[model samples]
Target: MRRNVIGSVEQMTGLQVVEVNIDVTDLQLPEDDEQHPLHDGTRRVR
Candidate 1:
């Protein structure tokens, strides 16, 4: 469902989506928790 939405936005705006990131910072631990932030939460197109 998410992929289709992003693809539609890209097609409509003619702007390519450089990346798709999904993160869960709230669920991270202090012990060597190396995870990227959430970009999936963002649905805005360029």
Candidate 2:
């Protein structure tokens, strides 16, 4: 449902969608504490 809407918008705007990050995971976190605070909460689509 949401994906269809996104496709429609992209078609109308003719802009390239780099990525649509939706979910976050602990495994994506960095082992370093310094990097942890800088984490953007990004995750793979599938």
Candidate 3:
């Protein structure tokens, strides 16, 4: 689901997806209200 959403965003915005990190170890996903490190668009994947 996440990949689909990301792919759609990339297609719509034409932003290159340089990295895709799937932290399966993080079994406890963050709550919607909580902040995620990757959620911040500060890191330039390229």
TM-score for each candidate, following the candidate numbering: 0.35, 0.32, 0.33
Residue pairs that clash (backbone atoms under 3 angstroms), model 2: none
lDDT of model 1 at residue 23?
A: 49
> How would you encode candidate 1's per-residue C-alpha lDDT over 1-46 as one tens digit per residue?
4587689889999998877665433443455344535544444443
Prediction 2 global C-alpha lDDT? 0.61
lDDT of 3 by residue, 14-45 (tens): 99777666554334344832466456534344
- In candidate 3, stretches whose alpha carbon ends up further than 4 angstroms from where it belongs are 17-46
lDDT of each: 0.61, 0.61, 0.62
Q: Which residue window of length 10 is worst by lDDT in model 2?
A: 21-30
Check candidate 3 and list the clashing pairs: none
**Better model by TM-score: candidate 1 vs candidate 2:** 1
Evaluation by lDDT, superior candidate among 2 and 3? 3
Ranking by TM-score: 1, 3, 2
Tens-place lDDT per residue, model 2, 1-46, is: 4587678778999987665655444454246644766556654355
